[model samples]
Target: MRKGLFFLCLVLYAFSVTLTVFVQHIGIQDRLLKIVCTLGILLSFFAVLAMLFLAFSLKGGVESLEQKENPAEKIPSKEKYLEFAARSGLSRRETEIGWLVLNGLSNIQLAETLYISLATVKKHLTHIYEKTETSGRKEFAEKVMAFGF
Candidate 1:
């Protein structure tokens, strides 16, 4: 829609310029030339206005979609998780794993990201679960949120 409006505006502008030049060179009567020029100017003005309206509306729609798709605004920050780990008596490695888990990384992904083996990632998760007195991922997340982490 935006591209179409822009193309329409371009065509109208070109036509207006061509009509003005042709009217001037062809020795038309002054009254007819004035009427033609006025009509052409009005058409060009409306085309520009339509293009501006489409551009702004499309921009607004894209911004709205971005906000809807991202909702990260409501999620807590990484620092909050770090602080939660500290308060929960987690060691540095456990805290690191906890942060990744809380952010929704899988054990395999965590292993890849931290450059550790899958067994090592599982071991860290077990330690975090034990330290937080939680059974698994779901409970761990619930506990952290309950504690205002």
Candidate 2:
């Protein structure tokens, strides 16, 4: 549908340009030719804009569908995540950071949420990584999920 809209817009612009050129060559009165060209330009502009809007909307729809198809990507329960973190020997702050990380929060967001500095967030994340035996957010999250708490 998006591709069809794009092609339709292209065809409309091409036809308008051809008509404008032909009208000029046929020696149409200046006023009529100007009006025709102006209308054609406006039509082409609107067509292109509509096509672009549809294309972007369609792309968003596809992304939404993909998310719906993958249920496992959703954030896990807080209790379950916290349980796994506790079992891993993480400190109180490290466990909190681990839960945020599992929920897909960035370091900046974690800092803001916990009212701590970015450096502090990083330090906690490092400790969480060490305790969980994982290198980064992705690995940590996978390991936490695999615990089946």
lDDT against the true structure, each candidate: 0.81, 0.80
Tens digit per residue, CA lDDT, model 1, 40-106 = 8788788778778877888998898776743233335777767778888899999888877877789
In the predicted model 2, the residue pairs found to clash are: none
**How well is each residue in 10-53 modelled by candidate 2, as lDDT tens digits?**
78978887887787778788897789887887887887788788
* Span of 10 residues, lowest total lDDT, candidate 1: 67-76
Error of 2 at 128 (Å): 0.7
Q: Which ten residues in a row have the lowest lDDT in candidate 2?
A: 67-76
Candidate 2: stretches off by over 4 Å = 1-77
Q: What's model 1's overall lDDT? A: 0.81
lDDT (0-100) at residue 15 of candidate 1? Answer: 95
What is residue 43's positional error in candidate 1, in angstroms? 58
